[model samples]
Target: MIGNNISFLKGEGYDFCELKEYEYGEDVKNIDWVISAKMQKPYVKVFHAQKELNIKIVSFLNGSTYFGTKKFKQEVITQIASMLGFICVKQGDPFASYIANETCELCTKKSKKIFNVNFMAEQLFNYDVIGKNIDYEFITNDLFKKIHHKSIIFLIGDFFDIEKLDLKLLSKKHEIFAIIVRDKFEENPSELGNVNFNDPSTNQNFEGVLNSNTIKNYVNKVKENDHKLFSHLQDNAIRFVKIYTHEDATKKLIGLLK
Candidate 1:
């Protein structure tokens, strides 16, 4: 069961085993004061090597994910989530998933079962991108209450309108690995004559001629936005990976994991 596999690790090599009465040969510093106070006797912490690890994935799916030049961003999210789930199962760890789009769904699996992993992956793949906008702040705030244990978190999204403070707060509780998926067109639009651009998230329409000046400004804006997000992640010590829609998801994910 999931509860059976739960364990705690401490320090460089100390894995918490249990608490017991202080023995003659036990180190005085190892005493668990709170436990001893409750028991009216001295207790020392014990240690052993931890045997399992837990992994949690928080996926943010939005309408922007549907726009892609090659493979859809939603597909990339599924592939990456599936890969992590398989890795967790192979490591004999419990895997949990919290997917957010217009609404949120939590899949908490305690067993190391392939079925559980595949179910989560399928949910991600089939998620519809009908959300008006991704409320990343709201999602992160909800996650703060839901997640109680220390686990590796995979935060997957295009991050169109994410707040830096929310990410910082989320990272404080768990080891966060950020995956920013993007389409080629998002980074650089084709220099077509005059075109009407629609914002997928807001359903807003913008009509403009794709002249040299317009393209330059658009590219620069995209670069500036990406740089800011990257800098914030780096400053907070969050591991970040960028995946393009056109790239092979398996190869890219493997390389990033390595």
Candidate 2:
């Protein structure tokens, strides 16, 4: 609606409201079939919201996001971002995005436009994550400075390298929700005999043997990293959820909101 007569999707979600008798041409998906059967009449759900939220989705992308056992982490991140943006549009909320890596950052102009939603998703999905890394501390500080007005911000990423995150300052002005997109195999792995692997962040090749002991060590390190990350986020009262690449990102994100 902000630009051309170009059409985009809507009705992805809405705030809950009391149900009423179903009407013709209404979406049957909204019908509470159980309630309708009990009352012996067709009834439909209703949703209402008086306040609009200013929403921002910040994608912390790096080379690690390019891999997934089932569906790539980048794809899951795109799905989550697109769903969140569409929900914002449906609920009449202004939306913006920040797609960043170690070297570059792209911040979109804030608007309640469907084009922005589509464009943001496209950018995230097609983004090249090769030979790149993410600096959580720098990203957090930058966000704190740029996003002035109070808003709801969702940060999505594969938090493999969060040695230290300075989110305390950013959480003061905005309600922060962190979505840690990961692959199941990253945590639980099946050992492949001696093989060569390339470091995604650095693009450096190395030879190593993936044995049970190595897998155990790697998983333990990942667990320790996550423990520290969770502790920091909890200390700041920032709610977070982990979405595996193989899982339904949209459903999980919606559940997090609920």
Candidate 3:
């Protein structure tokens, strides 16, 4: 069952296992009445195919100092992570997450010992936004290697610093997703007049005149970058979703799931 769930979700192969005979307490929706009738017994249907969906959610949070903008990227990451964790548990999917520090945490389904509200909250609270020279390749590689079966991976970040990413490896092994965090303020500052700019990650100073011309130029540059990013991901068969700090993460995630 576990392997099937993983493989199905990972886009690897189609297979499934027989779920435990429908227990009385199980939701009625899960009961396979057809199989029971065929068997001439009270046995409910269970999937024996390898495609039983076992969900393993991997989220990459932006645990860098530069993420402390008015958008509160950290909070957004935490909320999405928590919400996703809850959803996975609700769906009986085994869940796991990878933080920037190479922390590999997993939660077995309904495992009181493995996961709970407090446990997830602690992981969010203890996360310190520090400046680290993180190798995304290492993280992505580790995730693909350890993740033998199929799973969903959420790579959430501003990606202001990622020079290049090799998603083919990830896409080939697992179903991949990229959640981009963008701030409106960065996109258009002309309305704000002359304002100093600072890089969130490096705290680098960027003193510039936020005049009409500069604003137009910045907006154009941002749009160009967006186009390039979209094209690159699309060409690689990777899905990309954009989330603005001004928008709600729940709405965005739900839309993606649909």
Candidate 4:
């Protein structure tokens, strides 16, 4: 379904980059007729091998991703990662995956093989996130230091700790793409009267009345948090997309990268 996604990074090379004077034995079909006519000589479109994109999939597997009304957020992230890995495999570009939380681990090594992609997705789907909270500062710092070359990093997470998240330095050298996976209820919650809330990251539980005021306050806080987060991303020129639990991860990703 996502076969045509990320047209810019079709996971293959030999892209039509420029036009040059046609050489002997060059295919006539590739000739740019307009340019050829203007130059009074045959000029053909030249295809240069596209640079191998170092694809890095970073999964922030915090406890919050364990919840969802239809499907778990982690599952959605896994699906997205699988699709991305497939893209890398098809294009013959090496891709790796990292799972970041209180501790970070390289879930998959740099390889164009299909096994790594499946392994990465499996690792993500089964990861235990009960008490795990993302250390964004550490993750970003490590990523900046570890990846010496420029890369296309796809960050999949809920971003509950947006205040602590900073990617300015990382974005300077690498392209950052944030895939925020969330449940709709988290964004626009309905009043449940009296309820107990759990801080998934901290494993802290609190009992409170989930009335109109609470819902209003929570929704407003979410909006404010997103505003700040989006502003920071835009200022750094980091591209991003939001995928809800009920949404198609493939379509959202295609729209973002295509």
Judged by TM-score, which candidate is best? 4
Q: Name the better of 1 and 2 by lDDT.
A: 2
Clashes of 2: 0
- 101-201: candidate 1 lDDT, tens digit per residue: 66556865666789988898888888777545677767777877778887778888897654433677778888888888898887888789899978777
Backbone clash count for every predicted candidate, in the order shown: 0, 0, 15, 1
Output the better candidate (1/4) by TM-score.
4
RMSD of 1: 7.4
Off by over 4 Å in 1: 1-48, 107-111, 163-165
Pairs of residues at least 3 apart in sequence or in different chains that clash in candidate 1: none
Q: What TM-score does model 2 achieve against the real structure?
A: 0.79
| lDDT by candidate, in order shown | 0.78, 0.83, 0.61, 0.87
Model 3 C-alpha lDDT per residue in residues 146-223, reported as the tens digit of each score: 778766776766655454555778788777778876666766653666667655444567775667887788788878
Q: How does candidate 3 score on lDDT?
A: 0.61
Output the lDDT of residue 171, model 2.
87
CA deviation > 4 Å runs, candidate 2: 1-51
| Residue 36, model 2, lDDT | 95
TM-score of each: 0.77, 0.79, 0.68, 0.84
- Give lDDT tens digits, candidate 2, residues 181-230: 99999888899989898878899998989999999999999999999999
> For model 3, what is the error of residue 114's alpha carbon versus the real structure, in angstroms, after optimal superposition?
7.7
What lDDT does model 2 reach? 0.83
| Reference-based TM-score, model 3 | 0.68
